[model samples]
Target: MKFLATCPKGLEPLLVDELTALGAEEVKQTASGAEFSGSLESAYAACLWSRLANRVLMPVTEAVVETAEQLYAAVQEVDWSEHLDQSGSLSVNFTGSTKSINHTHFASLKVKDAIVDQFRDRFNCRPSVDRDQPDLRVHAHIYRGRLVVSIDLSGESLHRRDYRTESGAAPIKENLAAALLYRAQWPKCATEYPSVLDPMCGSGTILIEAALMKADVAPGLLRSEHGFERWKQHDAQLWQTLLDNAQQRREAGLASLEPVFFGSDIDTKVLNMARANAERAGLSAFITFERRDVKDMAPPNEAGGLLVTNPPYGERLGESSALMFLYRGIGDALKSRFGGWRAAIFTGNPDLCQAVGLKTDRVYKLKNGPIDSQLFLYTLYRKSAEQLAQAEESESQELSEQAQMFANRLKKNLKAMRKWVKQNDIDCYRLYDADIPEFAVAVDLYGDWVHVQEYAPPKSVDKVRAFDRIKDVMAAIPEVLEVPLSRVVLKQRKRQTGTNQYEKQGAKGKFFEVGEAGCRLRVNLHDYLDTGVFLDHRPVRRMIQQEAAGKDFLNLFCYTATASVHAAVGGAKTTTSVDMSATYLQWAMKNMAANGFSDKHQHFIQSDCLVWLKKQRKPQFDLIFMDPPTFSNSKRMQDVLDVQRDHVELIRLAMRLLRPEGKLIFSNNYRRFKMDYEALAMFDVTEISAQTIDPDFKRNTRIHSAFEVRWP
Candidate 1:
């Protein structure tokens, strides 16, 4: 018998080796599968033992098919009675297409028509189409106008391990997961019965496959039937012998299986699914499932084991930044906890894998459904404390010539800024703001904590080299600044669009108190891209305080209401803060309450800043801070706002509500902002961008632009 074992793309070589190992002869590899010469028993064994094969096919016939009629005629020549009785149920799975057949479903129907017509004309009975549990599962492939028809020995694709009735978010196909484990050398490890773990195991696909391999259980053992079972030439005795041998091996293997299998997921529901899947796989007693976050995962016991998982890839919308943090956390946890263990990470995003910190020893290319992915293998071993300290010293000395220069520049910047920060009584100020162009992160000290925002490198920069440079900076910052690693928060700063600024990046809602200008404000480091307070806005907030005394102050687009709190602290008679987001408004209220400014006179209103500005009766404030977003198309807004185009009208509207002596501080962070001097010629407009920028943000002088407008 000639058997073909089909698999996913890029897995043909592995499938070929697997088929050869399973007693297949004359094995020849193909693009997505392999063809081999073997007996009926070998074909049966392939269906049961070949983990990577999607299905085992027995070719019935082949012919040229230039059109749909030709395809039907060619399929009709296969002699259907040999595989299925005329009354038995059957199904056809058509793949590929020709010029005459553009859709697979149409091709499948044509083949079904041919088989039904042939049976009806000869035996006066036609097989009914049974898509589910078909007595004869026919597979037809058309490539370059030629068709080959075969019977699917495996009733369904072998990926369906029959154990996973439920799956978590973005589940990987079982066969692909098995390939990843194979590439990780888990099969070899199974012989030793070494421990196995999936820290981010969504539904235990990897753990179950590992257990099956370790227990010498056939992949198809759980299935009640295969497509060949109902055939007229079926070998019942041979199959029973194979089954009995498999069952006996499973019993013997399970008795001596020493490797402990552990699975953990952050979500308990997914962990429960894993437990149920293990139970259905008949390996429940040998595996342990727990609910634990990836970062909290530690070695199950003292014995080193294989740590493997398929972590999220951020392919979904609005998940890149969060997944980046998750990957970084996973790396950190592995570095701190999983010493002397072998690790493998399967991810669709290789860029995210770079953030894992650990070096990869090997990488295997594979596909997860349609997404191309990689499995990275590494050995997690940590040096002793003394050796680590020595390595640190060696790394510092081994810094490249360019990196040494960058480090020296950072040292110089920090030395120059210390006296100024001390004089200003600022606990949090920029110590290094990209002093070296090669190092593009702006480092700031938030009390004892360090907040570093990595500026996106330009297209001309080598990203890999840039990432290495960034790592150098991160490693040097804690040592140079003498701060704990936990106190360092690194975030990538990217350009925002629409209401991305208003979106919550994390759900932690963890906040810490930091003192600024004699005011205690809550700063959230984990929740948003912008830390609760803008460090560059220190001078601007101070200017607001100096100008706001015994006056009605209005703050537009008041994010977190930091500016309003500053105005109130400077003794504003009445303060009103308006923003579009209820979330930010709530945060604003908390900031005010935190600063002992909870009086009713301090108000926060959730409304579109533009609409609210138009509704203000007249001259309602002596001082107004109207710093709108650079661009906004929020659903709650009446219209899209482009600061460059609408600044003239925006300033005019504010001037109408400004008293003759009142000042409107209009500000934006648009990189290139030009004020319409001719349109607002009636009012006195003075650009204070230079004076408002703190020393920390002086390098990027356009970090924000502020102008004081008043009606004379």
Candidate 2:
């Protein structure tokens, strides 16, 4: 059959590549889609594995339709009875480009009328319009005054994936989320020592998708019905072969994938939905589901892992104040507890990034519907005081002179930027916050994200001054952004780790609140130079109130335990918080008690959370959450904790006490964490980070990441 596989815009190449790999013939690209010809098997293969397409459209006819009357006449010329029976249900969908026909709905209506009229005249009985559950779905499009008609080979949208049993507000499209993971290079996460996580794992779409990818499970296996199933030309034997092939693939995938899926959300309903979805997909023993607030995410064990999440950006769903609140919390959690780990956060709102605290290394442009989105890759680094001092002492005096020279030059460049802002409409804009090449330092007044560039020492003061000029040029960049000066924050860089103390200097960065969503996180940005919030985990935090009631919450690492605060708000009965930092533990306790958790039901332990786990006499916990730092050398604990180095061991420790069917949620921020497949063979891992991100930091990676431990 000759087919055109339609996909989202700018994804034609991906479809073409897939068709070529499937051994199809004459694969060609189109502006809005792609075309290919192949045997039935090639078509089936495309349906099973193509990740970037929307539907498999099999063209039935092509005609020139000049006007509405001609369009109706051409449609009536086709034999509609060949596809749909007299009593069969049918629906019409249309798309049009720059031509006389502009409205999609009108085109669809005309095509539907033509088909129905034909069936009535030819078969003496017309097929009824059943848009909701059409047995035969015909699609029409008008491009360059030419109409192409085809049968919808896919019934439900491929993104429906059938893995989600339930959903939270603002859920991510499953396939789209999976595509994002593929773009991020997913195999590395599965192989890393650290587990992948979605701290905000809303409905668990990304988590389930990641799990399927890791396991190499066929996505079509979960689909109960497809468009071709009801078509008159449907072949039973061929479909069976496809099904058998898919099954074989699953078996092979199972043999290959060491299932390790972890999902966390504040909403109990979302967790329950995730649990149900996993079971439906036959992943009952492949994933663990939990109700956890992102703020209080503690490692179920001491091992660090990868954190891949989708935080919130208010542009799509809510107000700006609410978005800001969540962003603040996200920044706090990564700085306080997820250090040494890496994270990828996706968001659409660039304005509220002040919350994630950590500097971004790479930012990729993406799109969700019409809204422009971005993916930020953060390599969360934790350098000890000794390391900082050593670096400071290692630099030569000449280097210091060059660094000073760079600063001076930057001041000079700002002169031009100031002029541009005055001329432009931008009032609140970014003057100089991060991403200056010559300076190797940047600060945004509202600027919290840092992009550092590597550079060499200058030959002279003039050369050094040129480096500063680059920064000045950057300061003027706000004018291009159209944001105002008040909105643009500029200052010397203040980061957790850098080249040296002399190179970077600043007082405490500004401490801001989360959002206007009726939540307050008591976090300090000074002691650790990070605001007390995990912006990436905002969605998961919002999810708690819906699911946390009457549940017992376990938080490990519990740095400031902001997630604990969310769990308490969600009405958890007994919350146990553990951490090695006495000061942070104190804050966690304070956050809990402030949110109505009393000494009776809420408890805080100031000790090595993993070490204390050895004495675990607790039978089973309803919800288990672990968000450990990527690396930490605590005063109380002798050994250093590296998230990527010890995740499997930590997960095993947490599992020892998990009750039957209980959920264990773990997350970390090791950007390039490689899971130890040998160690995680006994359990299942799922990545649910995409759904976890909320509105404030929607463009940023929500959590470092999350994994669910599901077992048979």
Candidate 3:
């Protein structure tokens, strides 16, 4: 019998190899699958052992046709009894359409009609149709004018491993995960029982696949139903023998297989899903699922292992910049923690691979669903301090003259800012702000740490050169600041939506305490892009503290509540902080606690500032600090806010809760803000933007705009 094993595109070679190993003879590869001559045992074994094959089909008949009638006649001529009984249920999966039949469903209906009529004419009875679990699954592939019919031996796509009762976002297909393991040379590793880890193991697909491979268990053994089980030519005795053999092998494999699988993910919900998947697969004992960040993922055991993961590719717009930083963190973790392990990263974007910083030993192109991706195999190793120093010195020597000039400028800025920062007793301040047009990065120092925010270079810049320049800047920052490389954190800044701004970029959970104006606040440089505090708002916060003495102060849109901390420290009678983020509110509470202002007088409210202000009629504030986002369409808010269009109403609502002699200080980071002087003619409004600009922000005049409004 001629059998065809179908699989995903680009995996035909792997399928052919898999079939050949499983005793399928005369194997010939095709674009979508492989064709081979195999007996009943060969077909059954292919269904059981072939991990890459989506379906194993036995060709029933074929005919050349130019019209739908001819196609129906071709299917009707086939001996359906050889595949399905008259009283059995049947399903037809049609692929392709010709000029005569423009739709696949119509073609499928024609084929089904022909089968029903043939059965009715032969025995006055026809089989019933069962789409979900049919006794016989007929696969009809129509080319330009030819129809090829086959009996699908595998009812469902083999990728549905029955273990995945739940899935995470963008989970990989199990077959594809198997293919990744095959390409990672896991078959060889399985013999030695080497450890395996997927740092971003969403739903534990890869870990489960690895464990299945190590156990030498047929992936289909767990399925209770298969298309071949109900077919007329199923050969029950042969299948029973195969099942018995599989069970025995599985038992022996389990006995010999030592647990070596480990997986980690930052999302706890997905970790639960991973655990459930492992438990359902009977692989719970072999794998350990932990809720860990990629940056903190080290080898689970002392034994050297293989690290394989499918990291996020930033397919969404405005996400690539953030993912680039994440890729860098993954690379850093690999270098620092898992030195002896082999690592494989499957990603669609090549730019993200460049950020990994490791030299790729091998790269293989494969399709991830519809996107073309590359699987980069790397040998991760830790470099000695001497070797790293030598490499940095070599990179420094190769830096371009332009990059060298930028480095010199950074040195000059740091030299000049040292005195100013010391005189003002500022522990955190901006050291460089895009001093050069070609090198667009902001460098800020927070005590012993440094945060470098890279501005997305324009399309006109050569990406390779831009990357090199950024590396040069990173290299120079640590040298100039006299800090270790690990103390320097790099982030890419792009136009971010209000909703995404609050999202955590990493899961380092590492925070450091920094001092600003007699206030000690915790700042996280790794987990978020903004470091929990905006350095540019130093002057604005200081102004709020000075003007908030002996008054009921209100801080609206209080991100991290730095302004609220200032007001409370300045001896405000009562202070209320309002924000939409619970995380920021927690951070605000921490900041307040750090400043010894965690009493009832210092309040943090989690609510939409607009809604909270509208509800405030009796509890009036003596001084209000309102700093709204430039634009917000956050789903948490009842209404979208555009500061340019809604500033008037926002200020109006804030003033309603203001006492008669109260002051309202409104500020925003919109660079091109133009206040509506005509709309606010009722109050004495003074623009203090120039005064709010600190010495560190002297290069950028429009860092932020502040206003003081009061009814005189």
Candidate 3 Cα outliers beyond 4 Å, as residue runs = 1-6, 16-42, 55-157, 160-174, 181-234, 243-345, 354-364, 369-371, 376-407, 615-619
- For candidate 1, lDDT tens digit of each residue in 74-123? 99998899888888999999999988899999999999999999999999
Q: How would the candidate models be sorted by TM-score, starting from the highest?
A: 1, 3, 2
Estimate the TM-score of every prediction: 0.72, 0.52, 0.71
Error of 2 at 36 (Å): 2.9
* Model 3: per-residue Cα lDDT over 525-632, one tens digit each: 887768888887889889888888899999999999988888888888999999999999999999999888868898889999998888877737999999899999
lDDT of 2 at 482: 44
The better candidate by TM-score, 2 or 3, is 3
After superposition, the stretches of candidate 2 with alpha carbons farther than 4 Å from their true spots are 10-16, 25-32, 97-105, 298-305, 316-325, 328-342, 354-361, 380-712
lDDT tens digits, residue span 279-305, model 2: 887776766778878877754433555
lDDT score of residue 156 within candidate 3: 93
Between candidates 1 and 3, which one is better according to lDDT?
3
TM-score for candidate 1, please give it. Answer: 0.72
* Top lDDT hit: 3
List the candidate numbers ranked by lDDT, top first.
Answer: 3, 1, 2
lDDT of each: 0.84, 0.65, 0.86
Better of 1 and 2 by lDDT: 1
Q: If both were scored by lDDT, which would come out higher, candidate 2 or candidate 3? A: 3
